[model samples]
Target: MALKPFLLTMLDQATELCHRLAAHGLVVASDGNASIRTGSGFYITRTRSEFENLTVDDWRWMPVVGAPTTGVSSEWRMHQVIFHQLPQVGAIVHCHPPYATSFAVRGEALDGTLLTETADFGKIAVAAFAAPGSGALAKAVIDDLGATGSACLLQQHGALTIGQTFQEAVQRMERLERLAMVQWLVTAGFPAHQTHE
Candidate 1:
């Protein structure tokens, strides 16, 4: 069956978004995954798909209520839970950007007081560490974000952001990293900089 133009456009935009993340050095190789919520399900990047080389074939349509298929991202459970619990969210971006994930690893959290971009987000909650792709991790994420937050950090793992639009989610991720960077600088004192992953 032929795919509708809007579906095609969604795939195209997802592909472009992945490429943009790679171009900005926000994600490397197959380091992250993204999804767009559809009425019945969602579209997500396939496992092991490199962002810089992503094509439409790298995406898969996943039913919201079923067991995830073999090729879908391992973190699909996290995305699935968020969509199910947060009806207002239309898109999700999960990435291990260095700056933000640094805070995750250190058990630190970012707050809206840090930047104007983060103002509406309040505290960027940090979920307790759980093995990747586990139901426990999914529960942690939803528990944190579901309690009135738009972004979260997976302890010792990465960051996740959701939005009413894909671009909004992507921008939030960017703003998160930027906020982390500035926070580090301000806390570290002047003329002395530290780097992290």
Candidate 2:
């Protein structure tokens, strides 16, 4: 099928974000996915595809108003719920970063109390545990979308972030992972540098 202009843009963006995820070690193999809304639908990375080697053919375009799950991410429900709830969001990126996943595994919040950078990214709440690809997980993510949160750590899972653009979503994911690392370092007895006048 011929790709629409918006979908074409989304494909390019998804490919870029996927490469970024792999290059920055935020995800391994086919562990992460990126998507962008085109019209009332979205273009997302295909399942089980490596982010670093994505191609135009690796994208699947689906209508946002449908529940069909033939060839989309296993977390499609969560993505759909989030994008539907946040009209301003144009892109979504989900990845499994080491530090963030570590915190998730421990059922800890990725809060700014650990570092200034975390504060800059706002507070990262750790959503309650929900089985992967389950409706429970989707609702858990929705509940975490309260105030002062742009990203959330899925307990025992990974991380999810949204943005006004593909680049913005990718940037948030990167920031979230960095904050996770800092949180780990601080909690592991490495004191963070204190800014002073």
Candidate 3:
């Protein structure tokens, strides 16, 4: 990984974000990856990285194009493709937070009826099913996210969020799952049982 000065602070920030997300039950095991835009490329969490225990050396540098390295996170293509597609997005977060993944596996959209959440996220869309680590998966997410560029639910998978900064992306990921949790609680009559694949 390219250890540029611009990426140094992000290393610590991203590590903290991962730990926080894990503490809040937003991500588990090796289930999530994050990336930040570098001057020339981006540094993504490597495959099998334990988010809560991430090290500064855990990231892999990847360009916007060309063949992706396998040791890096399998979902790098999704981040790369989005960067190429939307210039405004500066960070990406992909995670399988329980509530959102439950909705995704059931092939449902997180209800946009909550005015407060809807006003910000617009609509949380679930992309058509595509095999993980494939370009098709990236395209599916891109298609579902549309031009406005909010968070998206990967069918039978998880959630993806893009923002102008890594902090913003992390917040969006948290918000999406929280919204889904609230919706499930209200509609499913409490008990609060989370079902996921």
Candidate 4:
């Protein structure tokens, strides 16, 4: 089926956001995935897609309720679960940002109180580890994200963020990584660098 202009625009924006994510080091190679809920289903990155060169056409549309298909990101199920359980979430981003993933590897959740940007999220929950892309992972993620939380970290894995728009989701991920970086620096006794701004 032909996608409407609005959907096409959303695809373009999503593609651009992926590039931004890559340029900022939030995602590398084919390491992360994103999706936007459209109508009854959603458009997601294809399996093994490199964000730096991702194109709008590279996204695949899958029904909200359907059998899993091949050639899509292994974590598609996680996106699907959020859409199904959190009716307000219109976009989802899953990535392994270095600092945030470090927290995940260390089995630590972000102290959302440290940064104004993160304060609203409170303490970001860290979901228990489950095999990547498996149903168990999906369930674990949704349980952590719950009905109101906007972000969650996957234990020993990565992080996930949801939003009413792709931009919102991407911003949350970026803020999350920044929060993690600040906490890491604090823990290491790295003196704060004075900013001219």
* Tens digit of per-residue lDDT, candidate 1, span 153-173: 999999999999888899888
| Model 1 ranges off by over 4 Å | 189-197
- Please write out the lDDT profile of model 2 over residues 1-102, one tens digit for every residue: 597786677677678777878899998988887788877877777778788888888877777777744788777778777777778878888889998899
Residues 7-32, candidate 4: write the lDDT tens digits.
88889889999999999999999999
Clashes of each: 0, 0, 0, 0
Clashing pairs in 3: none
User: All candidates' TM-scores?
Assistant: 0.93, 0.88, 0.91, 0.93
- Residue 176, candidate 1: C-alpha displacement in angstroms: 0.7
Judging by TM-score, tell me the better candidate of 2 and 4. Answer: 4
**Which model is ahead, 1 or 2, in terms of TM-score?**
1
